[model samples]
Target: MAERYEYLPHHLLRRRVRDVASGAEGELMAVVNENVSDTVVEHWVELAYIRGSSGREFSTSVDNIEPAVAI
Candidate 1:
């Protein structure tokens, strides 16, 4: 079977992001999207400060987010 998204709602995860312009380096709260096609699953998170320009939210594959064991 294919991999599953283990992180649940309220779960936290650390995403490996770039260190360039507007790069994010910190823990992010996970918000799983239940409305997805059967073939795919995903979640939305806000790492970069949500504001003008960075107003758009980010969508990441469930596979990319790992459980935040500490902090």
Candidate 2:
């Protein structure tokens, strides 16, 4: 199953929805195990991206670990 996602920073203005769009509301999402091989493996990660704050952007990525978690 494909999931929809959106992000709202703490600095952004907050709003309330009064209607249902047949979807979800959150910055994180988890799609069902579709179009993926059962034998294939996957990992949860926080990819590096531009973070805009104080009128500046920085480059960063997940630190290298000796052993990745299995669970």
The candidate scoring highest on TM-score is: 1
lDDT of 2 by residue, 1-71 (tens): 33222232322112211112222222211112222324345333332223232433332221311121223
Q: Model 2: which ten-residue window has the lowest total lDDT?
A: 11-20
Q: How does residue 59 of candidate 1 score in lDDT?
A: 50
lDDT of each: 0.39, 0.24
Q: What is the lDDT of residue 67 in candidate 1?
A: 36
Put down candidate 1 lDDT per residue, 1-71, tens digits, no spaces.
Answer: 33333335543444433223334333453545443335445533323211123544455544444432334
Q: In candidate 2, how many Å is residue 56 off? A: 13
Candidate 1, residue 9: CA error in Å?
Answer: 2.3
Q: How does residue 38 of candidate 2 score in lDDT?
A: 41
